[model samples]
Target chain A: MTTMVLSGNEACVEGALRSGVRFFAGYPITPSSEIAEEMARRLPALGGKFIQMEDELASMAAVVGASLAGLKAMTATSGPGFSLMQENIGMAVMLEAPCVVVNVQRAGPSTGWATWPAQGDVMAARWGTHGDHPAIVLTPWSVKESFELTVRAVNLAERLRTPVILLSDAIIGRLREKVDLPPSVPVVDRPRPAMAPDHYRPYAGGPDGVPPMADFGTGYRWYATTTTHNERGYPVGVDAAAAEGLLKRLHSKIHDHQDEVVLTEGRWLEDSEVVVVAYGSVARSALAAVKQARSRGLKAGLLRLVTLWPFPSQLISQVAQRIRGLLVAEMNMGQMVEKVREASCGASEVWSVARFNGQYLMPEQILDKLEEVRRAWR
Target chain B: MALMRNRDMVERYFRRGALPTTWCPGCGLGTATGAMVRAIDQLGLDADKVVIVTGIGCSGQVYTLLNFDGFHGTHGRALAAATGIKFANPELTVIAPMGDGDCAAIGGNHFIQAARRNMDITAIIMANQAYGMTGGQYSPLTPMGSFTSTSPYGHIEPPFDMCALAIAAGATYVARGTVYHTQELVRLIARGIAHRGFSVIEVLAPCPVQFGRRNAMATPVDMFRQLQRATVSVREAELHPEAIGGRAVRGVLREVEGPEFTAEYEALIRRAKGDTHG
Candidate 1:
């Protein structure tokens, strides 16, 4: 392993290159600009293409187009840009175009803070696009994990034939850390059609529920549309059964393969009374607080979620049933906390230690909340 | 013999069982699309080497009717998607078919930027004056004082001069042809596709049911007659400016050589790889 000091955004770019991403179309947005800048410098050297698109929507559309044309592609943005990206991202979902979208989240309902950290886009990552679609969202807490999860994000996108979100915050995006990078990592390319172009159906999946994708100009002459489409990739207007089947398959393809898609890190969960569930940068502080609490004999544990969407429900339910209280810590105003509560099913007392003041939820704030919850439990 | 040859061309270029399109009776989109197909056939480009990227509009359905790889994407983003396709695989010919609203309103930024970049893509803006799919809403291409669904009072804003916009935005090739002039439209589209840089072929198609009904020209023939009477060849317009009056000039308005984006990017890649010759 080679040791290098890099920011989270730079690490993400490195990871994308390592994952065989050859095309990057992005607009410069705060906290995410470093990713685009690094890509612009690095891609051409590797014979890859990098384009600075006009806006987030165009960036996303370009990524989808590149993906369809047989190149692994990516784009990065912040909150306001992320909002602009939703429509095309929905098109990506409908078309099942495999690409990675990295939102280095900043504070915003709309352009709130360009340079500060906030995990306010958790829900947006899942349902920002207007549809009942499946989403794969990965949250990275550290610079090293940013690299690791970006690789995972691209791999999952290709494997599932879906767009994946690498949700990093401004703090994690800009945080510099010394990381020991591996020489090579496992890479997964999208499944290619085994059937001849004459008989190939674009949306007809094998057992995996992900159809083999054919690149444009590959003699498949396939059709892809943003409308609800049949297995042949043609729009099935007013065919309720076909639409339902398509929607279900789009969803079940991710949910059925949950074990492969979801990743988490747990610390001191055995014999713990209170568990702090957190993700992204807040998870770093939560881990530290859990360790500090353990040192003080407080029986605090941590569940650091690496996969946020398809929301690790079974695991959360199991943990909730075993724990006395669950404290959800995040840099947003009680977004994932609601998901936690829903997943817990009232099996444990759920409390939220939330903040959205363009600041990180500190270790002390989480520990204090843990203590308060523990006091109430006693 | 001509009918048999046309049938063969249609069979080779269009998808079987996809016809009887959802277009209104006498809609000029079909004629424009037919001209485009004829242009492609005349160029003798391989079907596998072409991809049609369509935006959300009636014109966007052109790709579905043709037997080629297609990307039917969201509203106003066809050019953006085509840009990506061309960058990813420069071997493929990218064509985008968009409506007036799709090209000038929501997708206006992408259109200008693509042209400015001199990307190798053919953009066919089917200017039907209003949004036909959504029941004739006023669009940026709707003429000033034209009646539309939203313009119960006459539309107050002047329509965009799209050919001028394309030229100013650095399009290497720009042309205008109406559906009434099918042969000229085919020639313009063919030439636009042959151009190596960004090309814009704005086909003035008529939405007889929506746009034409609101105006005096209610029938398809009426609209076609109006188009034929109201447009003149660019050469004719230049020679007899007084006789041309307010008629739209129909021909290649601008064609110039410029550096194509994908080739430039390839050279950039070579330079980045330390190739001195690049």
Candidate 2:
């Protein structure tokens, strides 16, 4: 292992290259521009392709197309660009193309703050695309986890045959930290079709619910459509049964395997009265606040979410059942608090600690919320 | 003998049990699709090595009927997707078929930039004047004062000359043909696919149900006759300028050699790899 001080965005580039991503297509956007810049500089030297597309829509489309052509591809953008990418991201889901979309989030409802951090896109990453589809979203709080989770994101996307979103905030994206980089990390590639070209059905999944993909020029000759398609990869216009089966399989491919897809980290949860639920950059503040509260004779702990989507509901429920109150802290205006409340099933009082004014949720602020929740419990 | 040869070509290139296309009875997109398939067959291209990327429209359904691997993507993004396909595997032939709205209006930026970069792909713009799949809506290619579902007051916007836009955007090969000129359209498409850089072949396909019924031409034959009378070949126009009054010019508008995107990128990769002789 070698020690280097790198920002979250730089670490993500290293992780993507380590994960065997050979194609990078993107448009420049703030906070996420470093990822694209690093890719532009690093990819060509490694004999990979890097393209600066006309817009985010083209970037997303190109990434999906490259993935289908048998290359691990990615694109990075901010909120405005991520919103533009939603339609093609939906296309990626429908086509079952494996690619990674890194959204280094900045404040928005339309460019609210260009250079500041906010976790407002948590909900959009899950439901920005139209239709009922499965989503795998990974969040990282530290620079080290940024590299680790990006590798995980690429692996999960390839294994499940879906577009994975690495949702990072501005603070985490620009924050610098010294991390030990491994010489090599495990890489997973999309399963190639083992069946003969004549017998292969492109969308026919095996026991794992993931169909082996064939490259375009490899003689499989199977077509892929964004429209609802049958196992033969032909459009199933208004065929309710085929549509239902395809949609359900798309969902269950990731949902049924949540045990491997969902990941989280817990602190002081063995004997704690108040547990703070947090993710992304706000989790750093929550962890610090939990430690401070424990030192001050308060029974407090932190439940840091590494996988934001598939919501970690089971783990949240288990933690909620054992705690007196759950403090959900985030850099947004009460997005995941609702999910925490639902998962807790009224077993614990859920309090939302939000900060959406283009600033980090400081550890001191989270400590105040923890104190408030503790007093209310009494 | 001609009918037998055409039947053999269809059997060889078309997908089994995939025809009876979804196009309307009198749609000109069928003719355009036939011309494209014939061009591919004439060029002796391998079916397994070709990938057809299409956008959302009545014209986009052309890929579904072909035996080659295909991607039926969302509206107005076929060229962008095709660009990726070509870049990822330069050995594969990427053909993108898009409608007027899909090519010139919503996907205009991608079209221009693809040409500007001189990406190696063939783009067949089926310029049916209006959006036929969404009923009859005015598009950027819809002629001025043409009535449609969206433009009941007669479209005030001037239609874009797609061939000129492509030439100005630095396409290495550009051509235009009407669906009425089936043999010429096939030849143009074949040449476009053979070009080393970006090629745009705009086919003036008639949307009889949507574009013709609103205009004076109510029948498919009337629309075909109108196209035959309104367009002149580039050689004919040059020979007799008086014969080309306000008629649209057909045939190759631009063909020139320039650096192709993928080849240049490969050289850049070699240079980045510290190979001095690349």
Candidate 3:
């Protein structure tokens, strides 16, 4: 009943365990390696399993395989390895197999900075894999949230019967913070089809956008493919009908349930003129920036995203209409700023401050950007 | 031929029904498949407790024919997927089968790593020496000078010796055979399945329309006979690898190991938990 202080990395593994993640297969990469190491040590005695795969592709592929075999599975990797995993991530989505992936982002393009903090993967996690498909990504700014979000990632994966990505980064991954857990938390179980084999077609949708899953040995006969598919999970050739069907499901599955997927922590946002929009470490710095702005007699609020994908576009649009000038602070060359700009449109002047080197956005850096935007507007 | 599971008490439960596969005339996937079925049977693993995983290529379709659990994943990742499945439920017997191209070329990294770590599973590599499903492209295991769609002028790269790689990479059990020699192949597969660590049975299947057309064995049967002739048993392989040309080291090459990855990982968890409280 006693709560222990844990690092963000430690919380990730704890979250996975609490969520009933019995299988973790991954290859050790910088920033993300701690999650894999922790999982490797913990899964076995829990009546689970851990594997250090050959590479990121294999690590990603293994978790998807385990998910299909009726186990909650996960893998962790940083930016470079995450890129390698995109190919298989697409397959998991197409097959509608539920699995969790932890992407503890590092500096990128190549293995830019192996042991440094950077949030360059925010946009890459969105459109990294080929083709038009939907993704669920969560962000955790501290150790407690890392654990909580990792559990939520697994739950979302089961609820949606699709891959749910926990978007973490080097700063949050390595940062030591006090972690607290709820007295009680429920893990979402993946929905299993109750119909007999004859009545089963794996891809048939339930009332929710998710389809019921039938594990490999459960006497269910269903086809799963990356190609456009019909209700039976059989491949439909890529044509007008096929493309339309595939896109419709992809969009509807996530869009219709955006409220469940997108999460943001609103702090001092309701009555502020300028709102600092950020996620991950940028949000941490923005907190400091907002404090500095308020100390300087400026009305600055912080809107921190806990979920990156599904973008929380409606929320951004709503805030954009009220806020005077929005400041987007990030660690990439304007990756997340695009989302803010798109959502804000002409309602607010979207100001972006970003960097690509393996470094967190400093508090002063964000404050400077906010001042520049405010002066230009004034 | 459909299985007579009832007569043999084989508990006919591979999948929903029998297969009328779509392989070409005189293809050896059927024989390899039969060998797998018999191996699983011979092991007497609970049919309900088996999971067969496959990746893209001709062999990917094999999962559909089996009654046990099956995961047909993306190209070149059957082993990767099987590792995950094994970790999820260490009680289940997981098997991975992939074509030469799927395992060696596209999935080469996973294969070597799986063997190196020696995860508990049976991997049957159906080495037809060409990419069969994608209409005959050059594969990693395809012998140099073998003609394929991509290698019309003759494959320029040397072929990978799959069995040699498996043995070197620390597979607890390793064997080489061919569809040409079904009885021996099935026996090796069964032994591999029962070996309790990473086991690899490389089946030298004939790709008649693709590989055999240029590696140009006189016939599919003759191609198999070559396996019968080319291989030396483990004893002989240890003695004189050169005598049999050394490509087909056709018996158990190695069978010693530490505890497998999953069990060790589990033990670690037990230790971690014990330290926590009790």
Candidate 4:
């Protein structure tokens, strides 16, 4: 509909606005502050609410609260802020609030490098919170993909009644690119309660397993807690079976609908002997290396992951049989290589090309790894 | 029979079978809860139009006993949650119940910022002087030279004057009441709820089993008597500064006019939407 040049963070904010996000709460941090700054500037024009909370913890808590009150809410942060957000992230999961959390990741165990790129938070996004709950994480490799995937993240969050993380890194987040964005896109809203005021079950769903939500002022006044709850949204502590059922349901709602939740893109995997598994910013390099290797008669392929969590294990398992070897390239010290290795199940050799010195993985570096894997296979 | 049925006062507001409350007997939390219910009852607020958010603590469990749009959530984040609720639905009356430790220590940033923003919400800080739910840990509100489980020796830190902190942080309505004076607490709470700006009513409740048993006040009656003896009226406190060292100030400490957050936000929305008349 329209062509424009925008950075990944700018497109992220634009996409969120287009996706019906009206409430945004955030604390400023590097590489992700543009999302908050953009939200503050644009939200007022649209009559939406934007708040700069005192810290990341409150920012997350506010998002959960706003989502409960029936506005699609979001928050953004980098590594340290994302780490501080873990406590309330668990709360959002337990309460099943629909909100988006964007973590434009930077290199860090603790504030390692503020302005550099790294996929160090891949596992943290999945298991950072203190409990066993399902997570939906979407990773994007380009400015346009960041915009599009952010919109997708919001939709999935509302549809599933859970928190969704849009995992971007400094490389994609700061890099500017020209792209065509749609004039309008389809916006999906959470299901509304079908039952009467007196009979509404806020946590009960139909065949889809996602319950209709009610806002605070609605007549369906019910209690929500971090503790295990029944269908009526009341805490059902000490009842072992009820707790088990609730936990199982929370995981199954996302797992059972894997077709909708898991998304990936495969390039030249049909007849290639070497496949490179990559995501986020590093995927671009992997693509470059794949093309170079193909030109050199090495038969290399690229499998770029769009949805980082739910692992896309089925896809890897399916393609593992045909490929002789796989190279997993990322910005961290081999976080996702383990997943590829496990999914391959030894059908193919899994090699890692990880760089964590606050730098992006180069195409040549990826090509070098692919050459090594090719040599080993021969 | 003369009439159909009569229910107990607490039962009139509490959720059915959600009671047999877990609060310790001789704990002032029950009395404080009763005052809160009476305040809401006196204000005649609709249950469907109210939301009670609680942080993790003994105070956090209050939501389960009452019928309303309630959220019992993470430690020290009740105000943050309440802030969101009020922003989303400005017409709804949002209230948060938090403990001294939960509000002043863990959630201190939110408390200060919420007041600074003058957000339209009422926060009831239960000043029991110790962490009751966690087995009598030393809290930010524990009096100087007082003993608790964590402070096996006398606590060296001075307690926070919650009302003063709230007033300094720009709360429009700030007050202090004790469980010993239930009627006053109900009145203060109701008035705070009626205010359209940030309001705080700090209730000096007794934690007999956790705080009192560790300190010199071993019995609930002793705690109540101490509350009565150590508290001075607002007028008396101003007049007799010398004798007010060990005494707590009671009554409204601050009530002033200011722009309410929700009302201002509504006007912003109207302006943004190009509605000139608003």
The numbered model that scores best in DockQ is 1
Ranking by DockQ: 1, 2, 4, 3
In candidate 4, how many Å is residue A307 off? Answer: 0.3
Minimum summed lDDT over a 10-residue window in model 4 chain B is located at B1-10
DockQ metric, candidate 2: 0.85
lDDT of 4: 0.90
Q: Between candidates 3 and 4, which one is better according to TM-score?
A: 4
Q: Show model 1 residue runs off by greater than 4 Å.
A: B1-5
Decoy 3 TM-score against native: 0.89
Give lDDT per model, in order: 0.93, 0.92, 0.80, 0.90
lDDT value, residue B207 of candidate 4: 95
Off by over 4 Å in 3: A1-3, A216-230, A233-247, B1-19, B42-44, B214-278
**Model 4 per-residue lDDT at B84:** 87
lDDT of 1 by residue, A1-378 (tens): 999999999999999999999999999999899899999999999999999999999999999999999999999999999999999999989999999999999998897989989999999999999979899999999999999999999999999999999999999999999999999988999999998998998998779899999999999999989978899887897889988989999999999899989999888887788999999999989998888888887899999899999899999999999988889999988999999999999999899999989877899998888778777877
C-alpha RMSD of candidate 4? 2.4
Candidate 4 or 2, higher lDDT? 2
Clashes of 2: 0
lDDT of 2 by residue, A1-378 (tens): 999999999999999999999999999999899999999899999889999999999999999999999999999999999999999999999999999999999988897799999999999999999999899999999999999999998999899999999999899999999999999998999999988999999998889899999999989888899878999998888899999999989999999899989999999998899899999999988999999999999999899889989899888898888888899998888999999999999998889899989988999999998888777767
lDDT of 4 by residue, B1-278 (tens): 11112255556777778767899989888788788888888888987899999999999889988878899889999999899888987889999989999999999989999999998899999989999999999998999889999999899998888899999999999999999988888889999999989999999999999999989899999999999998988888889888788788999999998999888887877877779998
